[model samples]
Target: MEQIWDNNDWLESANHWVTKQLKLQKINSIGRLKPVSGWGLGHVLKQPTEQGDVYFKATAKLPLFSNEALLSRYLHSINMPTPEVLAIEETHQYQLTKDFGGGLAEDSSATLWADAFEQFAQLQLDSLSYLKDFNKQGCLNRPISDVAAQLQLLIEHPQLQSLLDSEIILATEKAIAKLSHNIDELSQLEIGETLVHGDLHIENVAMSDDQCIFFDWSDACISHPFIDGTYLYRMPDSQDKTQIIDAYLKPWKQHYQPQQVEQAWQLCEHVCYAHQAISYASMMLHLSPEARVELNTAFQNALSASLRSNRQTVKSTTCVRSKFCGMVSGILHTLSLIQIKAGEAL
Candidate 1:
């Protein structure tokens, strides 16, 4: 099936609208729009102007992604360092923004990482006041208490179950009871729900004027802020990782004791992966079967990680030595375990 951007009529319409919008900004387009990247979910086009290059992104018409344009604007209005939205067509899930320079580089220094973490931590801290705005913008609202039901739904999802072994399915079903306990314990700590960059990573952050500018709000949601730490725990450098983690936790320290912050962070390890599984599974529901196949491995791996992390947490009350456990690399090792147990059932 052709993607929405592949339709000539739609492309022409977008181009015309962009040209008119640029004229309103008194910026002249120096060239035609160039396709940057595209997929079933959305497409990005680059348009060069006399002032600078601006980007146009259009997302699939699903509630999950439709809030990106408006949400991004709202974030900027609330003093978050997001890219400037040149124009937005919320009805169509289309947005245009001036380029914010290149994203955080692969070889960024530990200092930059620490700085980014500190800034983003404060961003999440400040986002609490605007929960109503975020909800009004249709952001996904996945509170911790609701995650158990999300897991139960995934256990009953026929399409997801079809791709899984009986043992894997049973493991997910078994994970719910223990996971629910962890969720309740963590909720008692009152860490507070805030904005979560559901797909956060260094690449999604742009460094502008030495400031960490976060963009790409397609997967933005409201949830426990620490769940946003999914990538920080996976960083390759232990020393730098510690620094980054400290910088992030420093902001939260003002609201809770060090013990509470540490405990919630540990508990969030498993819950974060569960959230990832639910997110991927939810996206799959909106995709075509062909597109859904593209995400099957990711969905399965996230689910597998969630269950594995929960069991690991159960085995030891203390924090696990390897923070990387149940992350991408750990998922590879667990895949082998899954194959070995595939024939067995609960």
Candidate 2:
């Protein structure tokens, strides 16, 4: 069988990206770029120069770069639980980042772990206090068109045909467009906006010895606090997820409405998997069968759960009922901080 990975190109691309994006010369073989399992675009490179541990992630085609950058800047400015954004360059097809990594996600004490999440949750809540306005700073992206393109690509590609459903597929396109229009309507209601870590899944976060610092600012943005909470809902472990939320919401549930928080979780339930589905399909197109089957199954389950949960999100304000009934199972929660690299879209 033909191997899908190009051993030579991975390292070559990393070096080129570092040179162009960081403008740092003298980056030696250091090590090779290893693609992070499950994620299609994130490439982790081991650097020999910086103690055989420091790594670089070159992410291209991330969806929410500007928003992520803005949010990371906001968090960093306020002293939040995010990674230091080393460098970023927003060209056409991708954005490159040099992340300051120290330890793995599983290596942290309970007190320290809680503190990290608490710090991050506090940062998000603080930002939400008087948050309002979007950065007319650069080109405004069209979410509908962008998501539609992804769906279209999958439909057109033979390799990813398994996941497509004609009726559901078409409905998803219209739903994405509707969501875009709803986003426009958000400002009309004078909804307060806070810095959001557009995509805050657990894998994107890493814990160092002294802190629980998070990386991946591609999804950073100024949006409803609910959106930020929803972003936090992606952690796979149920107990861990609650702990993260409780720590974040501890100091300030009074400042937020519970219903709104529920809304946020439901929204994330739908959109996060929406992202995963697209991501999974893209990976299936290029990955070996083993990788494809695992990701595809996960995507399928997520899509089903999201669809079931989002069904009740249509103006039912009592409690944010989601298909993933656990998030809103009457557990008040809180969160810590996130990071933003230059121009790397989430």
Candidate 3:
């Protein structure tokens, strides 16, 4: 059978696949297969069962899904709170995993955030030994050189030039040049790296009893441990930010000097922002023209904000540039494909 694309098609396939994989006689009371957010290359189905709920994720991008499965198994073996992988259909490019209930509450208390951060710190500390394994699994290795290259590509992209005003573009280029020096400074730091949950927002976390379980490992990478904190700092309210950082840093205090940890944290935040902007730009190619324009504007705005911040930080000694610029080259290359498609349509 051909791979499914739409949710309706996946639902039809899942009825048979789930029955065969789980050995269920019939799918009794299957809940609505709603689309999950935050994934561009795949779709997730929340399949309910008498026993419990299981999630079925189908992706055309096999490597990302396969990596998630591999990382989940590794984390499970290490006693981290990752969902169980139930089945893998290599041919269809789908996988089933045991779901961990609803996500963390929107108005979650400070206590819950504290517990989550503590667990997050412990996960980073525990996974240090498996850095080599993570790299072998095709997780991104974001070195300073790679990051500088990505920024350079973005600065030169034709689409980027057309998107921003000439003056703004010139300012951005100057900021990137200055930021390059700061990136070099970061390359000299003696920081240890581990598996970074590239996207670590509260929506990706679930609270089970007293334990905080994390899901959605598609963006996992091998980078500085503090890379995960990039999203954490952005998710909390301004008043709660200090507490969240303190909780996350409490466990690492024994392993790293306060200044070293703080430096890593700052660098990782900018890296994460740049990475996110690049990802959004890349995703624009897959969207409809109307959707593409909307997202393009958003990406442009975000890029402007990042450039402005970079300009300010470029004057400071603590400025650290991220290697997300490497991804920007690929995104820029896709502009030709988009142009070709547009010509064909005309």
* Cα lDDT computed for each candidate against the true fold: 0.81, 0.50, 0.65
Q: Which model is ahead, 1 or 2, in terms of TM-score? A: 1
Tens-digit lDDT track of model 3 for 124-164: 88888777777554466755445556766765778656766
- Local accuracy of candidate 1 as per-residue lDDT tens digits, 75-121: 77778888988898887678899998857875788788788888998
Off by over 4 Å in 1: 1-8, 315-346
The CA lDDT at 260 in model 2 is 47
lDDT for 265 (candidate 1): 82
Highest TM-score among the candidates is held by which one? 1
Better of 2 and 3 by TM-score: 3
Error of 3 at 13 (Å): 3.0
Task: Sort the predicted structures by TM-score, highest score first.
Answer: 1, 3, 2
TM-score versus the correct structure, for each prediction: 0.87, 0.55, 0.76
Off by over 4 Å in 2: 1-10, 16-39, 50-53, 62-80, 89-116, 126-162, 165-191, 219-222, 228-243, 251-254, 257-295, 311-346
Using lDDT as the measure, which candidate wins? 1
Clashes of 3: 4
For candidate 2, report its TM-score. 0.55
